[model samples]
Target chain A: MAPTLCELCKTTRALIVRPKNHQKLCKSCFISIFETEIHNTITSNSLFFPGERVAIGASGGKDSTVLASVLKTLNERHHYGLNLILLSIDEGIKGYRDDSLKTVKRNAKQYDMPLEIVGYDELYGWTMDQVVEQIGKKGNCTYCGVFRRQALDRGAARLDIKHVVTGHNADDTAETVMMNLLRGDLPRLARATSIVTASAASDIKRSKPLKYAYEKEIVYYALHKGLDYFTTECIYSPEAFRGSARTLIKNLEKVRPSAILDVVKSGEDMARLVPDEVSAAGQGGKDVLVVEGEAYRAGGCGSANGRSSGGEMADTERQLLESEKAQGNETEISHLGQKHDRNCKIPNRTLRKLPKQQMGKCVRCGYLSSQDICKACMLLEGLNKNRPKTQIQVSVDEEDNSSRLTRRMESLKIIPAEQM
Target chain B: MSTQSNEAGMVLLEVEFTGGLELLFSNQRKHKISLPGSDEKGQPATAAFLVRYLCENLMKDTRKEMFVMDGTVRPGILVLINDADWELEGGDLYELKENDNFFFISTLHGG
Candidate 1:
């Protein structure tokens, strides 16, 4: 086969045939275009301000690693005047997170940025390993998902930063949109489609600068540029519904590469069509922003970390479905009336008065919550209650203290274990 | 290197796996292997043949599905033939050449 010259340069041999547009480009051209598109996403959305203290949610994985590298390059090239820092959430998984955090530490030195590490053990008194031990691996993703959302927020708060950026690319966003669509969650769909989500309840604002970059492109950028990144799946992740959604997205991409961006565009268009009252009701009016961040953050963490097996959205949908089933008759009658009369104010008023969650501060942790105690506090309560029993069990086996000591040492070791 | 000149019916190539796919290949990122110069039908070996060849000869991991699905390289894994996307080089059907570099990177791994 003859060598194909870059479409843009028309001189050098093309190394990449872009998936989205079939635009052939050499290595340098592709890298510059990838960074430029991210720049476009950031500037067009007004993601950051001059001298803004922003935290990059680094996981040491490809996405966040590429995000940190690109942001640093663009900041210097465009004079964005951003004070960037790396904020890592240590889920404290024995073999997985420990190794990834090492990459993140190196990235801090390599990028010349300050780094902060927050662990579930520090914030919630329970590491994910401990949580999995207490409540088995069956539904532990719920605990991790709820915990990481608040972990990121608290990590940012500790840095005294007001903005956080994540590495959620177009593929991740498309998967979330598909997950929401599958679960029939229009309100969340609306929230998930936005590039930036901020809440009045919390001081921090979160955005995805790589929101439009393809996963393939991100990997290519990291590879061509020789950016170091860790690439291991979380050992505890049980392939959940999101896995299916992800497979579907990849298959669709194979058939038509533009399908990803098209789905994102479609999601945004659909979000705009969502009724205002429905979105308002979705979060109890003014607290939609915080809840929006929660939902969006959970979607990313759920898919990226593979932490949430059923996903937090799926869990919430299940609960909502059960409750709706309980009041099925009343809702069915109201629905029938509304169908008969599109302008029926009585049904609308009753629906509006259906006891929406009023956002407030958690009494214990003082984080924003619709319930008296925030989700994290509520989860911690359960884990705390079970802590003593596990300790007692461990104490009962104290005659084997030497073996137990070795086991503890093994778990705490930083080296990646041969087997998960 | 001396064996390469003596073996007329074999081709040597370099293969790489990253983005977590290395875990499926004994946790090694790079490997060089010599393969048959032609497929079962005697046609020049292609990328599709190399995938199957690697699975049979190179891969020690039992989870074959992680690397190949439905008789093809899985969708999320990117294949770069000599630093160029395999998509541009005729995808899986591109004929293999001696000393060609085939890189497989999985995008499925989480960030």
Candidate 2:
């Protein structure tokens, strides 16, 4: 077979046939075009302000390593004047996070950016290993998801930075859209599709600069450029549902490479149709809705790197739907004055509305929460109280005991469901 | 073709796996394997033949499904023949040449 010349350069041999458009290009042309598109995403979205400090959420994975390298190159070339730093979260999972963190440390030196490491042990007095040991692996993703969201915020706060950029590409966004769509969670779907998410309640802002880049292109960029990255799956995350969704997206890409971007665009279009009242009520205390005319961007961490799996979410959705159906049936029975009226149909308007979430701070730890105690504090309370009786006598700090008691009392109060 | 002849009618090629695919191939990224010049039908050894050969001989890990599924390279894994996408090189039917380099990278793994 004769070598094909690059379509763009028309001189060098074409090495990559881009997945999104099938535009064939040589190695150098592909790299420049990839960087140019990311720069375009940043410029068109105005993702960064000149002379603003931004933190790259580094995981030493392919997405992030490529993000750092591209951002650095673009910042210099376009004179974006952004102060970039690498911020890493140590989940304290042995043989997993430990190995990835080493790659992150190397990336910090390779990129010549300052790096900050925050551990769950120092922040919450429990590493993920300890939490998994106590809570078991079944629903630990929720703990990790909620904690990592706040940890990134706190980590940025310690550094006094307001914005953090993640490596969530179009593929991740599409997957999140599918998950939310499958669960029929429009509010979260609206939140998940935005390129930028900011909360009025907090100073930290999160955005995905690679929101438009295809995963295939990103991997090709890394390979062609020789970027160093780690590639192991989290040992504890056999997230069945997400794994399934990912497979679906990949298969769709195989059949039609444009399906990913189409899904992302569809997600954004559907987000615009979400009612203001529903979106207003979706924000947890820490995540305020940013409504700009018909455009609404709410703050929430993307589950791309977080361990939150679709299985737990699917279970929650099932329970919610069952309860709602039961309520609808009961309403029908009460209005019709019949115990078993199978013929009577429940009106769609009669479906119970999600309760409006209140914004407040945890009384104990002072973190943002809808309840008097935040999720981390509630989890800590559970962990602390469940400590073996023998260890309780050895280290019963008064501060810890008093907070535990306060949280216990708070738990007794009738707190609304879906506090987190 | 005569100049590229190898001992015992076998063709030597370089194969590499990355993006966690190496974990299945004895956790080794690169390997040099010699393949018979022709397959069972006396046709030139193709990428399909190389895949089966690797799974049967090179792969030590029991999880064969991770690398290949239903007699083809998994959907999410990309195959590069001589640094060009295998899709451009006639996909699985591309005939192997002596000293040809084949790279397989899995995009399904966590980034």
Candidate 3:
């Protein structure tokens, strides 16, 4: 085939080899278009400093891997003089984390970046499996979530970096915007759409350079560049929560190509009209502000100790721990009656108490806690209330129950089993 | 009705919004509103009544009247008084006489 003209620079050289759509450009020019856009994003947002240290939260995922590659490229081309480090949080989930971490390490080596991997077990004292085994199916995400977030923040802090960047993309932001709207979360919808980090937010200003980038484009970019990325989803995801949001976003996007842009535009518009209550550089009264439903935390030191976590732990932890202490908290509660001892409660408390409204309900199974019996137990209470009709199981093998439910759910097509 | 000793005195309305709705309302103009009004909290239809009553009250009273909603009031906020800024008075809460101004601002946050 004759060499096609470059889309951006009109170069007649096939600098780009085998672009998916026969798109042609000299390697340098084709690259400039993409690189320049990233540079613009960083400069416009002031996401990086000339010599300031910045940490990238790499997950070995398409978005993150691309972010690392582009940031490195931009740092060199734009001379942002950024000291960039790759920070990967290993949640210690079996296939999921181990595989992803391998990619992160490889990418770090390829990019010649300094890399740091903080394990869920090391930071939070428990992996997803152990947490699941101990805490059981009622609230599996509780562990990885609280632990993963703080793990990233703590990792950034350990590096003594001034900024932390994540791989959140346009799709993710749009999904979140829709999620907030459906839930009537005006503040979050107003605040979450920016392509840059709120440099004003203190405690290691977190950002998302990919907020405007499309997920499809990111995946395509990674594939085209032959970058390593993990294809597995989090193992314990039941597809009962954010899964719905993800699906909704996908559907909306299919219906309207500009759905993501519209959502982001709305969020931006709302932000302009809201109070000056933004937490700038983590200073000001808004700096101390906290919101509900958003439990992602800036990791701090000694996160694994259990002693550092506050309210979330007290409620979920104390209840489970106190119950387990009496009934071998080591023992996992099952869908049916059986038990396996597991050790974890500190970080789970952070999960439970994330939203005061949610915490008032039992974390065990998302129910209002009345007296000592939370919703998880309350479900059993209802079962027992059936007298001879309901045979209840309070303590059992945690994994077994979840798997059982997972299998049943698969059979019923409630969620595709492969997703789990 | 022009008694200098208006025993009714000034009525103050304090409305605290739910979340980050405070930054948007920073542009309100501190002006007179002379709407004869109602003394209540979360009363529906307060926007129109407030605009009319506050306009009439402040223009007539000549006392600096204000509407105190959280800084995150919604767009299209009907502040038919002056500019709806309480900065001239005591920030969000304005001082006044009877028939002073009352403004309705919207703030939205949920779980």
Candidate 4:
């Protein structure tokens, strides 16, 4: 076979077949074009201000590794004047997290950026290993998801850095869109599709710089550049809900490469239709900015939690907590059942009149929370109260269930026969 | 690295798998594989033929679906032929040549 000329250079043999668009380019042109697109995403979104300290949430995974390398190159070439730091969360899995953090350490040196690691032990007084021990790994992801969300904020706060960026690519975002759409989690769908989820109530701002980038491209960039990265599934069982959605997206991409980006565009378009009243009050008036070429952040905080599944579960838990806060306003039981009941008339009205986000410091940790105590504090209270490792189980008969999310949870349930 | 590619001969190639796909390829990232120059139908061997060779002869893992589906590399796995995107080189139909470098990278793993 004859070599194909690069689309841009037209001189060198093309090495890359871009997934978003089927453009083929040589290595040098591909690298530049990838970086330039990311630069456009950053600039048009105004993700960073000059001299601002932004932490690259690093897991030593390919996405973060590529993100660090590209951001460093862009910062130097474009004179962005950004102080980029590598922030990692050590979930304290005996063999898993301990090894990935080493890659992050090497990345810190390789990228010449300062590194900060916040562990589950320091934040929650419980590593994932211990959490899995207590919770029996059935629903430990809920704990990790809740804890990691706050941990990233707390880590950024500790560094006195307000803005944190993650390596969530287009595929991840597209998967989240599909997951949220399937789950009917409109508020979270709105949250997930935002390039920047910024709340004045909290100092830490979260953004995804690689939101427009494709996962394949990120891995390709890492491999082509020989950027050091680690790839391993979490020691814990995977979340079935997001896994199915991810599988669907991968299959769709296989058939149509543009399907991923199309899903992202559809998510953004759907987000715009979310009632302003719903968006305005959900995250303490957190403006969900859909910046131009501003890619939506996929499971950004799922670095330590693992995979798109972690992000979906965490978002569900978050929605649960927020709804709990809403129901705390004198409602006896959660409207979860009623909300899912299509015939329930009052639930629609009730959903529209969401309770104003009650921003307050967690009584235990001083972190931002809508409840009297944050979700983490609430989970910790439960764990500390049940020290003897009581089996906590939520039994939902899968056959009669109408909610796809519930059925997914049913499948993801770790069977007792498959114990560690 | 045998460079001979006579019609009735065999092609020696370097097949590398990474990003955890090596777990299926005998937990080895790089394998030197010798494959017949032509298939049983007497047609020139191609990448699709190599995928079958790896599955039937080299794959130590039981999860064949993880690597191949519908007669091609699985959706998430990337194929690079001689440092070029296999998509540019005709994907699964690209004829295998002696001493070619084939890298199969799985993007399914956590980033």
Candidates' chain B TM-scores in the order shown:
0.91, 0.92, 0.25, 0.92
lDDT of 1 by residue, A1-420 (tens): 788989988999999977777789999999988888788667756788899989999999999999999999999999999999999999999899999999999999999999999999989888999888878876677677767878888999888988999999889989888977776566667667777766433557888888778899999999999999998889887448778889999999999887887677556545544444444444444422122122222222111111222223213222322322333243233223334433322211111132435667889998876668766776677678774222211111101111222222233322222221
Per-residue alpha-carbon lDDT of candidate 4 for residues A1-420, written as tens digits (9 for 90 to 100): 478999999999999988766888899888888898888778766788999999999988889889899999999999999999999998889888899999999999999999999999998898989888887877777777777777787889899999988888889899888987776555556667777867534678888888877888888889889899998778797677778888899999989887787677566555544444334444554433321111112111112111132224213322222332332231222112233334323211111122344678878988876657766777787888876333433212111001222232233322221131
Candidate 4: stretches off by over 4 Å:
A199-201, A284-352, A387-420, B1-8
- Estimated TM-score for each candidate: 0.81, 0.80, 0.50, 0.81
Interface RMSD of 4: 1.0
When sorted by lDDT, best at the front, the candidate numbers are: 1, 2, 4, 3
Q: Which window of ten consecutive residues has the lowest lDDT sum in model 3 chain A? A: A350-359
Better of 1 and 3 by TM-score: 1
Report the TM-score for the A-chain of model 1: 0.77
- Per-residue lDDT of B33 in model 2: 92
Judged by DockQ cut-offs, is candidate 1 incorrect, acceptable, medium or high? medium
Model 1 quality (TM-score): 0.81
For DockQ, the strongest prediction is 1
Clash pairs, candidate 4, are none
Better of 1 and 3 by lDDT: 1
Model 1, global lDDT: 0.74
**Model 1's chain B TM-score?**
0.91
Please give the RMSD of candidate 2 to the true structure. Answer: 11.5
Number of clashes recorded per candidate: 0, 0, 48, 0
Candidate 2 deviant stretches above 4 angstroms = A285-356, A387-420, B1-7
